[model samples]
Target: MAAPAHTFTHDGIAFGGDYNPEQWHPSVWEEDVALMREAGVDLVAINIFGWAAVEPRSGEFTFASLDRVIELLHAAGIRVNLGTGTASPPAWLTLAHPEILPIAEDGTTRYPGGRQAWCPSSPAFRTAALSLVRAVAERFGSHPAVALWHVSNELGCHNALCYCDQSAAAFRRWLRARYNSIDALNAAWGTAFWSQTYSDWDEILPPRAALSARNPGQALDFHRFSSDELLDYYRAEAAVIRDLSDVPVTTNFMVAAHIENMDYWQWAGEMDVVANDHYLDYRLGDPRTELSFAADLSRGLALGSPWLLMEHSTGAVNWQPINFAKSPGQMLRNSLTHVARGADAVCFFQWRASLQGSEKFHSAMLPHAGTDSELWREVVELGAILSKLDEVAGSRVVADIALVFSWESWWAADAESRPSTAIGYLDQVHAVYAAFAALHMTMDVVAPGADLSEYKLVVVPGLHLVRNEEAAIINDWIADGGTALVTFFSGIVDENDRVWAGGYTGPFRDALGVAVEEFAPLAPDSRVSLDSGATGTKWSERMRVTTAEVVDAFADGPAAGSPAITRNRWGSGNAWYLSTLLEPEEYRSLALQLAAEAGVDSPVRVSGDAEGAVEVVRRRGDLASYVFAINHSNTSVQLQVSGTELITGDNNAGHNTAGHNTAGDNTVATVEVPPGAVRIIREESAS
Candidate 1:
């Protein structure tokens, strides 16, 4: 498979990260730039939070501080990713137009002390923000240092939803454009049941706090509008940047596990290049798996294009309750893992640790201890490593398996009045994704509506809201010999969050050859075993088989002997319906079995003699295939593969160290990958 298309203004993988030189004095700028060059920092993201510094007052702009920083970096031969600094409006703008402030659902307005305090729907905020963007672009658009235009810092980070009158008015306008009329809005929002029918367009309001339960359809639409509102904000800034500068534009996406509201798949189309900021949640989940999930999702948003790792912490982040620092070598491993997943640029949150303000404690390349710190040494070492691995840039991970993940379904399923509140959309999806990861499989976390024909196996887990057109796409893909595994609570609602009248799993009932009679939500203490030895918890559905054969039955439960797992052949393809959430091992077994049935395997498979500790990922470039052997366990792993180690000089005997088929025959070799280390090898072909 060919790699996805990407535009690179720089030749090699760009490093360095958010550099707030304005925070420090002008005297510190020279030393900072010198240190960055010594550490192999080629790129620095600047002006991210410089709204107040650039434009101190209304209708006035000054770029002396920013100009000095840019010049210093440019003189040092370090490229700049110019940020628009529109994410946080200046204090004067907010004070002049207080209406631009975002109001919470509880009717409290957010002040300008914190960032992202402006309402996305506020016209004044948009005008002010665009004016600043235009000013900045006009000033530095053609500058030799400016390589990329960062639209805004993580758009809609805090002000995703605004319940104020301005937002309500904007929401009504958006609804008018979408539904066209009040009657259409009423129908789409299902307002008749609650006697909440709208008589006039002015009668409609933003889904705010109410004494009674809010409309799910209204909330869903609000979610869509909020996401679009932020996208519009990004587009507005990007439009100005494009008009003034030919540089590529991007906004850092917070694709962390906790990010909600914004639909990145739709937002990806508006960006010149996709960039993501991922922060690991050490308190809740394993950092490695979370990083893998975020990076894969980001790459998928770019359509397998080499995206930017815009922001990540070198160690502890200040915002989390427990700011745990990374151990030795953890940061390097984290950076390499992102590269293995398709991130061309590996960057961090900031270059230097803050001495004051909220993020003073957050770790950075230059920590509080400066050059004397071990973190600083590690940062220099990682910079050296990235400088050497330039050959791996722009390569794409080749995967025959695709996991369909949707933010819309995540919102709908998590909405109130569901089959079970315990049904986490990502949790279900992650269980399946983790199983694939354990098997060293390279899978893309694609959108539900993306092109699926390229993938041999597609897994859709907990897709609660299935639009008619999306269902048709999946059904057509299955009929065309594509293997699909869809789980419970899927195909329940339509595009407007309305349930199909006949039964659950509306559009999927016919496709899966099974009809869900009712949802049997298991208690926390409850358990059910499948005939396939898969124990299910949290959820199970009672279904009656129609044209499908039962692959697994509920061994014991309220729905005992019912079809828990069914398989049906449609046209030339097959569809598997997992009616319950299975354990990781069982899910892995089922996933592997289905993959084998579909004739899908990882690009590089480990020998059977070794346990599955080292994970392998293959990315194909124009010249060769890049294989990443990552040891995630605490012990060493022996990996036998046909490739040349790109980082380390060591290679197994009897194999071509040049990574070419010199004798017209392939050679196999075994090497021990140490725990928590990564080995990137280059093979001639992906096969």
Candidate 2:
């Protein structure tokens, strides 16, 4: 068999999670280790929030406890992912340096009651954080068991806009670097309209609720500034660790996290690898939506390279309004989903449940009673399965489809009201994603400026803030035979949120072969059917088709029978224009037609029954490939497995027919997969 492209070769997928020995006694360490061994846990992320213990005073530090924990784990033959412990500042640091406390939007200083309360622009916080990181690195940089360096916990503040004096000053500097001149800034911000032009750097302030009616340009810049400030803090801490050690460093970013602009593309460059926390309410059916987007984003961050699954709740999250427990096979399936989607390792928010504090009710390997529970058994089983498939670890799966996910576009489009409030930036992106998901088409969600040569089809959901260079790049790709999907509300603004005055889509008008004259935001209950004979709801954009053919049209409203969806042919490529919010069914139908045009094949042959309840991911090599089918439903479903089951080692289950290869082939072999069950098939060489 051909060597797998992306697989976990080291015993199995790394199992174990965030371990906080500081919260427990030394006597409890032995028991925790034993429980970990029982659960086949080989890796432990240690010292995530142990800053208080690591640094007791300003200059004085203590590494004795941490040293002992690392030594013990190493002795037990377990790998350690050492954390810098800078996420939550110690009480003393906060009390001594009052600037560390972030200033809320109302200009009120927030007390340090919760973590992530530190002001990113605070010099005292930076100095103290860098000192502790340097100390940790100096002590354990070369530890034998150390595998990676985790920078901080989550790296997001509940209240993001810090209107403090320090933040305000930093925002001015950031704006200066971006705009260069006050006149340029004024022109870009259109401050002449509101008479809010700035005379000096000090006159500028952090955009807050108190100053709601400020210039859109200034407010947008403040958002970017705040994000950059926090990113600087992350970089500062990362630099400290890198100065002492060569181990890869990363901070866990929340999926769909909208705090400080955190452009993953820029942030991914600073760290050796990218990791993200995955927390979705199963009730919302958003796990498939969020995780798929997140996995693709992480993969895109490293240019299709594998990423770490840093933090996930094993069972229930206490923070949500209603804590729902993962069903019997749900946790295992979720972990495998991460691996199938390009995760290098699988770890959770916690290894052991906390006895006291806010996370006491959170689920973990060892429950609050300190006994081995179902969650522990599931963790062990997953570890064992990973061990058996160790050869598949560390391999990468190449994607032929790329969906454009831009932070700049999201920021700019949402900054001002143009089309409709119901059609949010994320919602539009997710609509395209849901379409792909329904068709069982695997795609990579990427940022702007990502390489377009690898993907045959490129979907830009909301390219609202298309820069001239980026637009040229897209046009070139389309001219070179790439199928481009551009949606409504796109090309409305430039990098500075300035409307592309000449036309709606700016430079993309010629590439799309169409011009949008006006936007029509439909009512919530509005309905429209396509001329291609499909129906949808919510909103639609009215456009004058310059050269494009109307593939679908609006069925109702003032613009009824108008072009709701258009197709334009440029060079040997095709451009699809969606002029409205499509219902789920309409989206799937249109997606199927687009996929066909792009020459992308669906992995799942049978559909409708398993529509959104299952997801398919394929990792292809030159000759062979592996297909993973995941059932995200709450009930068991039948899957026709033409290839042999990779995990079962049972080729007899599926039928063997003439003219078929050794991997097992059948016209139709119905395999009943339980809810949350993941099945992997090793496809035979097509050659």
Candidate 3:
């Protein structure tokens, strides 16, 4: 449990990034502040990795250096998002209590060379870590410059899973609390098979390395337990901060690529503001499509309330195999694209580049080239743009489509020994989402069992694990005139990791009006043909349609001439099922057809020629609406809109159609967006 959600205290559209003054001399701190002021940086994050500096020894206290840094920002009228600075524990404390170190899943100890090297369930580490948290909160809790309290830096980033004795005990304790007794635990874990039955709670252990294969139920429960442990840790820290300060508190969520340990659906309610750190992942088919999905996911976590973009890179990140810098205007589009979704604030991972560290290569607001660099100039330009769009703060993006996402499902479906290694949980998710994005549609990434009544359309893909009640929610909604699209390989297992009885689709089979006889996952580099002239890759299914209309059939594959896609008229609305992965363009065609059937339209549509090259979204408040046009193409895009463009502060002058202005407002006119540019139009209030 956490404190009731508090207010986001920063002024309109807070802008800044992580600032580390300790990495440089006292002389350099002044220059950093001056440059920050020049770039319109108002809110700065400081002391993210200050555990070693704040408390050099176990009990010693030192705030002299941090105090000076904060003082300089305060004097310049900049606010602070104070970090608890417990990201990494000091060397002395870990050396004294070696048991606090984390053990890998293979039973190897993890030393302190990297960040977050301690066990999440270790008592010694918690005590030392919380003491440092308390000290920092007590000292800076009342400072006027401190508006937000940033908890640890990206919790559960590296050491989410631990297999030490201490962690094993904690896992057992968590299980006990959930199942209540040894008998119940044994039943839930399905230990009656494989001679693995347990008579006492003490006999159970964390699912460590096994010879053949571990129990599926036990592995799933351990994942649940690990996520709960981190949530418990965050609750403890939040409790401490609320006891000491009145400012809002948050921890940066890695909602971006490759890190999916923590179940943020369970963690979002504990936060006052849902802040996320995103870096463009070039490994995906298209990074921009994934970016839109991630941003919508963050907005969903915030429940459509304005959230924060805690950290993004200015150009490129250091960690990817091949680091690539953004093009000339890529940073601007990236930052504003997040804003267009639902971010009230725009921030980055760093304010200045590091001279000596592992992340020194990461891009920053002030790069090594100093003021003369284009990156620095763009940072200043972004700040100015944010300042001009002050009225856009607190507005929320509206979406009629819901895409269901689950961290637990990702863990279970992507576990070892699935039907195919050619396809992954995220691969299908990103595929479907990119299809919608290409149509310039905005979707709210939702969780299963969430209220689907508010949405006109819902998309559920690759959901391998679901509760009975969660499936019921979707079925009930579909019967009430809400259009639903459920893809293949979903609803296979229940919460206990047991197969659902009737068919592969489980509880959803009746709603979708289709059931799978068996899975026909294709081999590597294999492709199949569809009757609709679309190509299917990576996956195919052998299924029979019962009470449905066949939309497409497999022309040639393992299940030749079978139904590939079907639509069923359930009660008041419709339910559609797609049993194979379609190529990108074909997927988009299917998705657009469904969206049109559901009567869900984009906020503003682009011309046919610029359909896939431009994205438009609207943020609406009671008094006004802001339309954001992002041009990803190299040619100019002209959109029909009626308002004053905020970026250039020009009214619709010559682009207005004659006699369209008779109603006395800036008539619907063509707004020419330059190649690789953005235009925000402030229009009249919503009726």
Candidate 4:
């Protein structure tokens, strides 16, 4: 695969945000360019929503505005992440071809007023969209300012699952390719239960609105087909770019809390460089933990390589029901945290805040207040800070633990007929990840069936759907001495959405040495006590012991006196099973106990008059190693290390936050980390 576009002049972290000069007049363009220079902005994305602008009429094309914007940025030494402008369709095309509009699951047409309103299977839309892509690529493919080819802006964000007739035809074609024949598809879909058997390909349809609960097998396949369709569309756009340009190609992946539409692992191999757009979703509290999880996940999609943060927010975002602006240094803290986890570039959703449109109130690098605001000051300071860590680019994050993240599990667990409405796959993953975060442990987020050989410890939480081979790999790894933590609702089904037959914990029963007799999903806001003196919520299971030792049992609830937690000595290593979701603190305590057994350790520790938490992560390169200490609290803390501090540019410019201490590579080197400050240390081997 090709490397990511590294176009900044100083060889430092790439900086800047989405820039739309067409939204303003040429008079404002000069000022915007000057401000970009003043803030040290080196990268800016243009023509992201250029579908309507570039091709205003069906066959008519205009490059006057786009050409001028690129010329201005190029003149100012800013490299471009150019968009193909197929993000959304223009009003004329949709009016001319109404069949291209997407249909909701409830059989409603998603109009073209919003972005991403076209159906993925519509040939009319694809032809028009691909034509626009070709026009953009042909015009600017060899342009000096163009550093990267952005295919489409956030594909599948608005229309992943469409129930139109075209989608049904496309679904049948995809099914034929996967299952090969009608008999094979029937076996996989388990159609006999509801008299839903298909005699031929044409008989099958996209799982549309139903009288009762939809078929799990059908629903699961539709989700898979939807993700595949979007990936296929992206591949087509990428093909156009590759034929015309050598610039690395990428489209921003919505790998955030609200999106689970795309199985990004399948799409990773197709990208030249993986990029992601992330925003703070207040629905999931503790923005710090949520931010780390998202950044780490983006890295995971890149296969642990350095990735670009294509979109974040400077302050409040406009989409959320209750948007909250970042408090004080939060903007800086959020940017650095992404860097701490291995983001080589930091960019936000926009450069200038919009004056009109759905995103009008969305914060940007340059707010509506222009350069006079404190937001602009913070943006400039962040730009300077990023420039100081030039050498930190291209380094890989260090991790010893692996967390299995499966989109299949997410799809299956979230369907309508699950045991509990509260057993959310992402929620469970976040809850378990928060446990690791509480212990200040950095972990690798891996997909199902990933090699566990490199990791000392593996964490599997809420893995509701596991293929036979995936289960076998984990079983083999554990028997070969890899420690693991497998939680509830895991190993329940195979690739076909069919049960594993023997017990609740299906293919994992042998490795886990425990049998889940039945699922006992609890009521909402419910609680159950465990023998370990910890309270559990969300779910509990009736289980029996085989070779596994019962570590904790239920004290009350449906499965009273049953095992709540189990530990099995499988071969040379250990496998622990959690039957219920424990409170955050208790979960972290148990995770630490397992970590101690696995010999996982972090060199850094934090304790002081600190008011908030400090996230510690390290990146390793052949020539140098660096530690990132990000303080997210209210009071200052001390980071003692023997290295050169990048921000202050001293031999060891440690902090005096804990009263006072010298900063040196030898003894007495203490760096005081002010609350909500970021410190990067280039370490010495001798220390």
Leading candidate by TM-score: 3
At residue 271, give the lDDT of candidate 2.
61
- Model 2 residue runs over 4 Å out of place are 1-12, 157-160, 257-260, 282-285, 369-372, 416-418, 604-608, 621-624, 634-644, 651-675
What is candidate 3's lDDT per residue for 1-687, written digit by digit as tens?
344468885568889999988898999999999989999999999989998889999999899999999999999999999999988888998999999899988999999888898899999989998999899999999999998999888999998899999999998898888989888877876888798989888998898998877888888888888888988888888889889999999999999769978999999989999999999999877899788889999999998888999999999999899999999999999999999999988999899899988899999999989999898999999999999988889988988899999988998898776899889889889999888888878899988778887899999998989999999998889999989898888999998888898878899988889878899999868889999899988889998988888999999989788889999998898999988899999999999999999998777646535658788888988788888889999887666666788889887632554223434674556677788999998874452
lDDT of 2 by residue, 565-619 (tens): 8889988788888888787877888888888888887664533355467877776
Q: Rank the candidates by TM-score, best first.
A: 3, 4, 1, 2
Q: Which ten residues in a row have the lowest lDDT in candidate 2?
A: 1-10
lDDT of 4 by residue, 535-624 (tens): 999999998999999999999999999999899999998999999999988998888888998988654555566622788888887788
Which ten residues in a row are the worst by lDDT in model 3? 653-662
TM-score of each: 0.95, 0.93, 0.97, 0.96
Full ranking by lDDT: 3, 4, 1, 2
Error of 1 at 610 (Å): 8.0
